[model samples]
Target: MKKVLLAVFVAGGLAFSADGAAIFKSKGCASCHQPTADTVGPSLKKIAQAYAGKKADLIKFLKGQGKAIVDPAKEAIMRPQLTMTKNLPQEQLEALADYILKYK
Candidate 1:
């Protein structure tokens, strides 16, 4: 029974991570932020590096409760996009943060 519960927990975590990538793509995040290079927005690698060891803060930024730390000068360009993420459920927010942080 314990093993079954553990497996379920692990699987659910994986699902969230996968869902995060899907959500990122669906929301047009890939249009500006590349996996390793900056375009209109900072690269995922840059974000991950700036956000390293700060997952909660990343989630807060996604929720619009935190400020931009990656590219403060260009934050205006990304601020508008927060509307798409601000109301996401906490789990999704965490998953999204996890996905971004993984680039580190």
Candidate 2:
């Protein structure tokens, strides 16, 4: 049987990528977080840098299973947003993390 392709990219070989930027936009994340600016929330660059090589922890945070290491002061403000991310499937979470990490 031929494999069905959703979206494919070549990393080491063939790979799949979810549209994380689309996810961010559809989820209304851009309303608070910007690509490089600190608005109501921290910038994607800041988060990406803080979580560099720490994609697992970032996933945990997205799943509502970790603390805010980026900006503790804004934890309360960011908490509610976790509900939006916590229920995402593994693939989507990885995609989201990948998208954020691209800024690093």
Candidate 3:
């Protein structure tokens, strides 16, 4: 019984961890920000590079607390998108940040 419960817990955690990319897509982030090439927004690689070694800052930015560092000139375009992310639960926010940072 204990092993079964442990397996269930681990599987749940894995599922949650894997939701980052899904959330990014479902939230329409991929509309502008592609994995490698810049479009309306900077590519994920650019964001990941800008945010490298700053996971907490990345999370804060997603939460609408931190300022944009990847492309301050285009912040106006990205600012409104925060509304979609600002209220996410911490776990989801962390997952999103992890997903973005994975490009680095």
Candidate 4:
């Protein structure tokens, strides 16, 4: 029973983490945001560094409650991306942030 429960927990973590990658792809974010290099928008590593120790703020930004910090000039370009994200449930947004944060 304990082994079964442990397996479930590990599986859950993997599943939740996978959502982050999926969200990035499905949201069309990769067009402008690369994992390690900047494209039209800032890179994920830059975003992670900018939001270091402030994951909650990052999540808030995704929710359309915070402002752009990494690429203010391209805020307009990134703004449209938020529309796709603003409606996502909180957990998914956190997962997205988690994936982005991993770049740091």
Candidate 5:
């Protein structure tokens, strides 16, 4: 039983997905940020493409410090979204950035 419990605990940690993806979905980012197609906002693929190799800049945006590099036209709509995520702790912000960068 001890061994079985250990296995289950290990599996739980392994089963956990990236924190950024969780934050994205919980914060309603996925509603507008699709994987490939544009919706209310640019898709994740587009954001990944535009911010390629610029993960720091992406995190900055999440922190409400960076400009809209992917879609300035829709920046107004996205600006409010920042309030939902900007105050997230640094670890969560990093995770969120990691999740977004994974789209590439």
Candidate 6:
């Protein structure tokens, strides 16, 4: 039983670790933000650059607690989208930030 429980726990962590990309897609972030090109919004690469070494700020931004720094002029366009990210659990938020940061 203990082995089964340990395996389950480990599996869950693995799944959670991969959820960032899935969550980004499921949350419809791909529509505006491309991987490396600027479309409706800045590319993930641009975002990663802006938030490099600032994962906490990135998470805060996603939570709607931090202002847009990469493209502040376009922030209004992204305000409505915050509702999708603002309430994510901390772990999920961290994962999302990690995924975005990896583009750097």
Worst 10 residues of 3 by lDDT: 13-22
Give the root-mean-square deviation of each candidate in angstroms.
Answer: 3.4, 4.4, 2.2, 2.6, 2.4, 2.4
- The reply for model 5, stretches above 4 Å from the true place, is 1-18
Better of 3 and 4 by TM-score: 3
lDDT of 2: 0.87
Model 4 TM-score (2 dp): 0.84
**Judged by TM-score relative to the true structure, which candidate is superior, 3 or 5?**
3
Which scores higher on lDDT, 4 or 6?
A: 6
Residues 10-84, model 1: lDDT tens digits? 999878655889889888999999999899999999999999999999999999889999999999999999999
Instruction: Give the per-residue Cα lDDT of candidate 1 at 63.
Output: 90
Q: Which ten residues in a row have the lowest lDDT in candidate 2?
A: 1-10
lDDT of 4 by residue, 1-104 (tens): 99999999999987865589988998789888888888788889999999999999999999888999988888887787789988888889888999899999
Candidate 4 clash pair list: none
Q: What C-alpha lDDT values do all the predictions have? A: 0.91, 0.87, 0.93, 0.88, 0.85, 0.94
Q: Comparing 1 and 5 by TM-score, which wins?
A: 1
Error of 2 at 104 (Å): 1.3
Using TM-score as the yardstick, the better of models 2 and 3 is: 3
The positional error of residue 52 in candidate 5, measured at the CA in angstroms, is 1.5
Per-residue lDDT of model 6, residues 42-86, tens digit only:
999999999999999999999999999999999999999999999
Off by over 4 Å in 2: 1-17
> Which residue pairs in candidate 1 have backbone atoms (N, alpha carbon, C) closer than 3 angstroms, thus clashing?
none
Evaluated against the true structure, the overall lDDT of model 6 is 0.94
Global CA lDDT of candidate 5, please? Answer: 0.85
Task: Tally clashing residue pairs in candidate 2.
Answer: 0
Off by over 4 Å in 4: 1-18
* Colliding pairs, model 3: none
lDDT by residue (6-103, candidate 5, tens digit) is: 99988776445436777888998999899989889988888888888898898899989999978798799999889998888887888888888788
How far off is residue 18 in model 6, in Å? 6.0
- Candidate 3, residues 1-104, lDDT tens digits: the string is 99999999999987766588988999999999999999999999999999999999999999999999989999999999999999999888988999999997
Deviation (Å) of 78 in candidate 4 = 0.6
Clashing pairs in 2: none
What is the TM-score of each predicted model, taking all chains together? 0.84, 0.83, 0.87, 0.84, 0.83, 0.88
